[model samples]
Target: MHISEGVLAAPVLISGVAAAAAGCSVGLRKMDFDKTPRVAVMASTFFVASLIHVPIGPSSIHLILTGLVGIILGWASFPAILVALLLQSILFQFGGLTTLGVNCFAMAFPALLCYLIFSKLINGKNQSLAVIAGFLAGFCGVMLAVIIIAAALAISGEQFITVARLILIAHLPVMIIEGLIVTTIVVFLRRAKPELLKGVV
Candidate 1:
């Protein structure tokens, strides 16, 4: 979910930019040259996925697939999300340039969290456990992002409390859909392309 540019206060926006900048720097440094194409592909996926949005409160909701990206790309999701968000802002104006940092952070932080929490299970030898982890990653990633968006809104106004709750409730379907999508992908990869899960941090 992309918060429109003018909704956030200056302090919140500044903090978002700083945090995103640091994460992007680390992601860039840790990036494998050989995986650049993979990064591009994920970035494109994120870019395209966010375009088909279902309107909600002040913004809209869509399938991020960010958990899948994080499990595969690790910390590199920061830069990947940043690039996608940048293009979305420029091409479609879905999210404004001024709000880019917060929007990117909103998506990328949950991705990092999913990576840390699920990487081991997804990379584990037990296929069942791996699939479960995949489901949780996809489910939790959206849940966390919803929480973050709500908190960001709550920071701006107490009136946003109801809006936040509504947004989370509205996204329930998306969470389940993403969970199944990620679980299936993980199962298939474990069977046909296990190498993709190797060396994930």
Candidate 2:
């Protein structure tokens, strides 16, 4: 979900920028140089996945795949998302440059949160638990992003309250779809490339 420019108040925008900067700093520090190519691939995936979106007031409905990125890239999702969003803003203008920080934080923070909450279970020996964790991660990722976007809208002004609610309602189906998609990916990775899940965070 990308918050359009001018929708958020100045204070909200400033706070978003500060928070995103902090996250990017941490992500950069934790990033593995050797895995740069993998990070690029994930960024490209994120970029492509969100290309098609249905505009809803200040935000939009789209398949973010933040959970998948988080599970594979961990904290690195901050920079990856930032890069993708930056490109989208520059190229397609899906989101404005002024709103990049808020949009990036809204999407990437949930990803980082999901990674922190489910990474261990996803890497655990119990395959069933891992699968469950994967589903939850994907489900929660979209849910959390919706919450953040709603909050940002509400905080901006009372006019956005209705739009905020609509955004939440519109994304329910997306959550389930994302959950299933992530589950399938997790299963495949566990069987074909277990190493991708380990030592990521």
Candidate 3:
């Protein structure tokens, strides 16, 4: 879902940078110094997860795991995702440097939204509901990112609509896969490390 450099116009790129900067500012402020280790771990997870792509017809799919990070780190997912994307761009050129802001925002915004919407339910008392919330977080995270990506491409030209549609169709399997993965992880964390959910509001 990385928008390559030069694909997006200057206005879109600037807007992405400005919006991501604002989110990163708030995320940095909300991030507790003690949780730096957890953030780093998740950043690494994000970095690795996105690199393992599976070919499906003309398009490829990968596990974002952004929802997993978001629920754990809350707003801090912004900076974590930013760092991961930067490294990916610098080291592998997976995403070009000029498009870094748009790529990061595309991935991170849905993560923040998922955290805000699902964090409470995941932390709530009912296990069943919490599991459902986890699944939704993962499912919706990809869906929202898909929409954002489509919108970004749609802005570039009319022909991109078809490409965007294909991208969404290709990602359908990933949505289900990530939802199940996140649900399982949430259940495990609920049993073994409930404290991770305790402090995050």
Measured by TM-score, the strongest candidate is 2
Q: What lDDT score is found at residue 126 in candidate 1? A: 87
In angstroms, give how far residue 81 of model 1 lies from its true place. 0.2
| Residue pairs with backbone overlap in model 2 | none
Q: How high is the lDDT of residue 36 in model 3? A: 84
TM-score of candidate 1 against the unseen true structure? 0.89
Which run of 10 residues does model 1 get worst, by summed lDDT?
48-57
Per-residue CA lDDT of model 1 for 40-137, tens digit only, reads 87568667766667555677666677688778778888998888888877888788877888888988899998998898999898878998999999
The TM-scores, one per candidate, come to 0.89, 0.91, 0.90
lDDT per residue (tens digit) for residues 73-100 in model 3: 7888888888988887779878877777
Deviating ranges (above 4 Å) for candidate 1 = 49-61, 199-201
Q: What is residue 171's positional error in candidate 1, in angstroms? A: 1.3
lDDT of 2: 0.86
Instruction: Give the alpha carbon lDDT tens digit for every residue of 4-68 in model 2.
Output: 88789998898889989999999988887877787888678667777657455687666778787
**Model 3 misplacement above 4 A:** 52-60, 198-201
Model 2: residues with Cα > 4 Å off, grouped in runs = 52-62, 199-201
lDDT per prediction? 0.82, 0.86, 0.82
